[model samples]
Target: MSALQALRTVSGKLQKTQIQVSTGLRVATASDNAAYWSIATTMRSDRRAISAANDALGVGAAKVDTAYAAMSSVVEVLSDFKAKLVAAREKGIDLDKIQNELDQLKSQVLSISQSASFNGQNWLNTDVEDIYDPDNNKSSVVGGFTRNADGTVVVNSIDYSMLQSALFNSTGGGMLQADPRDLKTIGGLRFDYGNGLMSTYSLRNTGGWGPTDFNFDFSSPITFGAGDSISFDVTADQDNPADGITPPYDAGQTTSIVIDAARVNSALGRTDGTIGTYKEYAAVLRSALVGSGLTATTYTRFEPPGQTQTWVDVPDVVGIVHNGLASKDGSSMAISNVSFNGVTQANQIAPRAVAYGTRNSEMTLDFEPFTVYADVVVSMRLRVDGSYSNLSFDKDFADLALGKDNGKVETSAEMATLLTALVNRPDVIAQASGSGTVSLKTDPLVDRKSGEKSMIGIDGISVNIEPVPTMNFLDVDVARNPEMIDGYINYIETAMGRVVSGAAALGSLQSRIELQSNFAKHAMDMIDKGVGRLVDADMEEASARLNALQTQQQLALQGLQIANSQPQPLLSLFQ
Candidate 1:
C-alpha cells in the first residue's frame, strides 16, 4: 500500500471524529444534528400553537363585537317603538293610522331584537333562559321572565337543529291541539245571571218579566130592601175587589180586604155604605129571597142592642155612607162585605211574589299571559345573520286574547314575545307561520259579531287589555285603569325606551370587546416574536458558528501532529 493512501485514510477518520465531537451529534450533516433539529422542530410546533390560540381569541373577540353591534341597532329600533307608542296617546290623532305606523316600527324593533347575534352565538337569544339578581339570588315570573327550573346558568344557547324544526308546532305535543278554537260553538240563546236573579218571583215589579200569573173570579147578585145592607164573595167573576186610594166609592175599592164570612149570606147589598166585588154575591142571596117572596125585603141592616163602634140600620134611601168596611188576611184572600148593583163578574187581585238569590258584592276575574310557538327564526346576533326569515318565539305567548292588554317587560323579553306573534302571525302578523297566532292567540279585541276570543294564556300570564287582532292594528283595552290610560300609555312608551336603551348598552359592550380583541391579537403577535428571540436558534448565526468550529478543529489537529514529532526525536536519541 502507498504511504499517502494510509495517511489520507487516517486523516479522513480523524476529520470524521472531530465533526461528531464539535457538533455534539452522531451525524455531522444537516440531517445529523437530530437533537438540535428536534429542538427547532418542537419550537416551530410551539409557535404554531401560540399563533392558533391568538387567532382563536381574535375570532372570539370579533364574535363579541358583532353581538354588541347588533344590540346597538336594537336600541335604535326600540327608540322607534317607544316614540310610536307614545304618539298613540294623542287625543285627536288618527289612532288607526298612528297604530299602523307603530306596527311597522314595532316590526322593525322585533327584527332588531331577534336579529342580534355574535359569531353565530346569540347573547339575547337565550333558550333555557335565566336571569341573575343579586337582590333575591332568585328570579320570578312576575317580572315576565322565563328561566331554568333550578336557575343556575343562563340558557342562552340554541342549536341549529332546534331552530330548524320550527316550521310548525314542534314543541312537545302541541301540534295535537293546533287547530284554532274558533271552530268551537254553542247554539241558541243563553241567559246569564250576574250575581243574583229572582226566580218565579221578584219583589220590585218583577212580574212584568212575565212567565204567567194566577187569578180567580167571583160573582155576586143581590138587591137591597128598606134599611138593609149586604156583602158576599164574588169568587167566579171579573171585578177588582180591592184596589183603592180612598174607600167607600165603588165595589172595586180596597186593594186588600178580609172576608166577612158571617155576612156571606147578608140579606142586604150594603155595608156601612162601602161595596166590594162581593156585591155580586150579595145579589145572588137577594135574588133567592125575592124569588121565594120572603121579603126581597129580607135585605136588612141591624144594630145589636148596645154596640158602640156600631153598625147602622139600612135606610130606604139608595145611597149611604159608613165605616168598618173590611180587613185583610196574612196570605190567602177571604171574601166578605159587599155593595151590589147585581150579580156580575169580578176578578180577585193577588200580590206578586218571587224568590231571590244571594247577592255578590265583588268579583275579580284574572286574565293571564299567553305563549306563542312558531317556526320563524330571527338572526339578531350579527348583521349578517339578522336578515334571516327564520324567526320564532320562545314559547311565552300562546293564548293571549282580546281585552287582555296586559303590559310587558322592556328587555329582549318584550322583543321575543312581540316577534313571535306579530312578526310571523298568519293573520295580522307576517312570515311562514307555525302554531302561532292561528293556533294560539294574544289579541284583546272581540269581533262583536263572532263573539269569540281567547280568554287567557296557557301560562296564566295576564294582559292589561286584550289586543284587538285585526288585519291592521289590534284594539287596546285599558280596563279599570288606575292611571286612566295615561300611565298605561306612558308605560308602553317606556317599554320601547327600555328596549332601545338595552340595545345601546349591548352595542357599546360589543365595540369594547372588538377593540380589545384586535389589541390582544397585536399584543400576542409581538409576544411571540419576543419568545422566538429567547430560545430558538438563528439559522444564519448557527451556520457561522459551524465554520468557526471547523477552523478550531484543524488547529487542534496540527498541535497533535507537532507533539508526535517531538516524541519521535526522543526515540532517535535512544538509538
Candidate 2:
C-alpha cells in the first residue's frame, strides 16, 4: 500500500513538471498558486497596455516631426526673403525683380505650409478667424499613458499653440500675415514751429527779440524830428478770445506804445529831449512799450544787405524793427492801427502781423511698424488755423482713400496718403517716411515766410487698438517703397526667429516622445521579467524535476510490483 501511494505521488509530480515545461508557467491558474496567478495576470495585462501606449507615442512623434520639418523649411525661406529685401535696399537695383523673387519665396512658404501635413494634420496653415482664440487654435498630440497606484488609467497629451506656428491663415493672424510690432505706444501728434528771427534794440542790450518772439521789419529807415511820435495798437495772444477776440479765436490783450523825442532822449539817458536816429527811436519805443505793460522788444542790429549773417549795428539805412512777445498758449500776435507824426518815411514802417515765431505749425504722427486690425480706429481733433477738423482713420477710411474696398492699408506710404486725405487741407501737408513715421506740417506756402495764416494743433488723438503686431509680409512692396525695406527685413527676421523656436519646440517634443517610447519598451521588458518570476517556469529547474520524478516513478512502480509478487509467502509476511 505504501509503495502504491509513493508511485501515485511521483506520477502526479511528473505530470505537473510536464505541464510547467509545456506551458512555461508554474502558476497558470488560480488552483496552482492563487496569489502569484492573480498578480502575474494583472502584470501581463499592464504590459500589453504599455505596448499600446508606445505605439501611440510613435504616431505623436511622427506628427511632431512633420511640423518640425515644415518649420525648418519656413525658416530657410524667411532667411532668403530677408536677403532679398536687403538686396532691394540698394539704391539703383531693380527692386521690381527682387520683389518678384520675394513673391516667389512667399509662395514657396505657402506651399510648404499647406503641404506640411501628416495624417490630415497641418500645424502651419490655418483658416480660423482668430488665432488668438485659445480653445480654437490649440492642438494636442498623445504623449503618454499612465496607470495610477489605485489602478486608474490615464492618457496625457503634448499641447502646442498655433498662434506663433501658423505661417498663413485666412484671418490676418498668422505669424507672417499679422503685424509683428506694437505701435500702440507711439506718441501722439506734436506741433512744431520753426525758429523766428531775433533782434536787439538798445546799446545797453536791455531790449531784444529773443527766440520765438514775433517781430515785423520796416520797409525802410525813418528819421524822427523833435516832437515826432509814432503809435500803434499791439495785439498779443490774438487767438485767445478771452483777451478780446470771438469764438474760434481766444481772447488776447491789446496795448498801445507811443514813441516821441522825449522818450527817445530819456531812453538815450539825455535830459535834452533831442531827436534820434531810427536806432534810438526803436530803443525809446521799446522802453515806452515796456512802460505800457506790453511785452515788446526793438532791433538795434539788422541783417546787412546781400549778407546772411554778421548783422552790423542798425544804420541810418535800416528802419526801426519792432518785436512782440512770444505767443501765449499757442496764440498769435499782431500789430495794427499805426500812426506817425513828424517822421520821414513813416509809411516805410510797414508792420505786418506775425506769429510768435517763424516756426511752422507741425504735428508728427510717430508710428512704429505695427499691425492695424480691422476694428482699429484712429480718431483725433485737429485745430488748423483756428478751425477744428475731426479726423478718424479705419479700414473704411483707408479703403476710401486708396479707392479700393480692401479693408487694409497696404503700406506706410498709403497710410500717409490716407491721413493726408483725412486732413483734406492744402495748408496741412502730411508726409510719411522711413517705415511708419507720418509728419503733418503747416504747408511752407502758409508759413511765416509766405505770410499766410498757419497754425496746427492736435487734440484727443487716440486709437481703439491694442498693442500688437499687424504688418503683413505679402503686402510688402519694396519697389514702390524702397525706404521701408529695413522694416520688411526686421519683420522677416522676427518671423524666422519664431519659426526656429517652433522647430526647436517640435524637436524637444520628438525627443520626449523618443524617451517615452524607450521607457515604454524598457517597462515592457521589466514587466515581462517580473511576471516571469511570478508565473513563468524556469526551464533548468523544471527539466531536473521532471527527470527526478520519472526516476522515482519507475522505482516506486517496481517496488509495488515486487510487493505484489511476494504476497504468497504468508508465514514470512506474518513474522
Candidate 3:
C-alpha cells in the first residue's frame, strides 16, 4: 500500500480505540450498536417498572399490617367484654355497673375500627354503603411483571375484600351486631293454679283423673223403702261386670239400664248385704251396684235419726292439676261439658260447680274459637236419689266462662280461680293449634337506622351472635331470677368463641400479606440483577481495554510520522 493510504487506515483505528476508552461502554447509543443498545434500554426500563411495582406492594403491606394490628386490639377488647358478662351472672352483683364496663369495651372496638387506617385507607370503619360496592371493597396490590409481544407491559397484583365473616361483620355477622330472629309459635300453655300449684295433665291419660272427677256429693243419703229401687246407667258403656275395669274401654262390652225393686228390698233387709234398714241401704247399694268399669262411694252426714243422711257416690279422682299428659303417644279424650242426672250436691252451684270441675259426667263437645283446643270437655256427676237433675254449663267455654266480661273474666279472683281450675282440669286435651297469639322474637343489638340485625367488623376481624336471642339480651332479667343465670353464662361463652375466631382470621390474613411482601422484595432483587447483566459497565474489562487502546494510539501516531518522513526523502530526490 502507498504511504498516505496506510497512514489514513492507522489513524482511523486509533480514533475508534480512543473513543472506546473514554466512554467506558461498547454500545452507548443506538448509533454505536443499534441492536445491542435497544435490547439494553428495554431491559433497563423493565427493571425500573418492576422496582416501582415492588414499592407499591410495600405500601399495601403496610396497610394490611395496620388492619391486622387493629384486629388484635379488638380481640382483647372483646375478651374483656366477655369477662364482664360472666361477672354479671354472679348473685348480688350489680348488672348496671357491669353493663357500663361492657359498654366501654364496646366503645374500644369502635375506636379501633375508626383508627385502623393507612395511607388514608380505612378499611375497618367503612360504612355499608361504601363496602357494599364491589370495586370499592376490593383491594389490589402489585404482584408481578409481564411483557407482551405488542410491546406493552403488564403488572399483576393480588386482590382481597375486607368484610365481616360469620364471627365478625359490621352488616350482619359482627360482635356488636345482632342476628335476625325468625317468626315462631308460642310454647305450651301454663296453668295458673290459685294457690301457686301448677300442673299440666295430658288428656291422653285414660287411667288418670283430676282432683274432683265427676263426684255426686249428696247432702243427704236416700233411704230405700219397700218396692223402691234406683236405676244407674251410663250413656256409652263399654263393658258389663268384668274381672277388672279396663280403661280406654274397647268395643263389644255389655251395658245395662234396668233396676229391680224386689232385689233392692231383699238386699236392704238381708244381713249379707250389710243393710238391715233403709238408712243403711245407700252404703250397701254402692257395693252391690254392678257395671263395667263402674266405681262408687257412699258416705253419711251427721244428722238426727229419721232425718235423711248425706252420701257421696262418684268415680275415683286422681292425678296432678297440670301435667302434660300420661304418655306422649298423642291419643287422649277431650272433655267439653258435664251432665248431672239428679239434684246438685254440696257446693254444686251451676257456674261454680262447672268451674270447679266437680260435675258428674263429662262428654266430648265441639266449639268454635276455643282458646285451648278444638274439642270442648264434657263431664258428669250422678245423683240417683235426687228429685231431678239440671245441667248448666257453656259448652264452648266450659269452666273458662266464669264472670264473663265481653267473654273475658272481670273479677280477678274469679278469673284466677277459673283459670286455676281449667289448668287443673284433667280431661282437657293439649292440641298443637289453638287461638293463641304468636310471639315474635328479636335481638337487642339491631341497627339503629334500619332496625335490622347487623354485624360489626373491626380490622378485618368479625365477631357475631348466632341462634339469635329470642329476647333482647340487655332486657334479660337474670339478676332477679337466679335460675336464669345459666342462660347468661352460655351467652357469654358463645361471645368468647366469636372473638377468638375473629382473631384467627386476622392472623391468617396477616401471614398472607407478609409472604407477599417478602416475595415482592425478592423479585425486586432478581430484576435488578437481570438489568445489570444487560446494561451495567464491567469496570475490570473496561480498565484493561482502556490501557490497550492508549498503547495502540501511540503506535498509530509514530506510523503517521514515519510516513511523512518518507514523503520528505522523495522531495530530496526531486532537488
RMSD of 3: 19.0
- Arrange candidates by lDDT, highest first: which order? 2, 3, 1
Best candidate according to TM-score: 2
Instruction: Write candidate 3's Cα lDDT for 397-469 as tens digits.
Output: 5344554422322233433334334434232222212233211111112211100111111011111211333
Rank by TM-score (best first) = 2, 3, 1
lDDT of 1: 0.33
Across residues 1-575, which tens digit of lDDT does each residue of candidate 2 receive?
A: 99999999999989999999999888989999999998888888888877887887788788888888989988888888888888887778898899899889988988999998888888888776667667778888776667799988887776777765787877756777754323333322422211101010111001112124444444454444666777777665444322222345434567776776667667888766654454554565567766222444444444667666676654443222223334443244556788878775443344556444233366555553333445667777877654688888776676778787645554556667776788888777878764766676665434332112335666666565432335676777788777767766766776677678778877887788888888888889998889888888889999999999989999999999999988778868778
Off by over 4 Å in 3: 1-27, 31-36, 130-136, 148-152, 165-175, 179-496, 535-541, 572-575
The estimated TM-scores of all candidates read 0.31, 0.54, 0.47
* Comparing 2 and 3 on lDDT, the stronger one: 2
How many angstroms is residue 133 displaced in model 2 relative to the true structure, after the best TM-score fit?
A: 2.8
176 Cα displacement, candidate 3 (Å):
2.2
Best by lDDT: 2
Q: How many backbone clashes does candidate 2 have?
A: 17
Q: Which ten residues in a row have the lowest lDDT in candidate 2?
A: 196-205
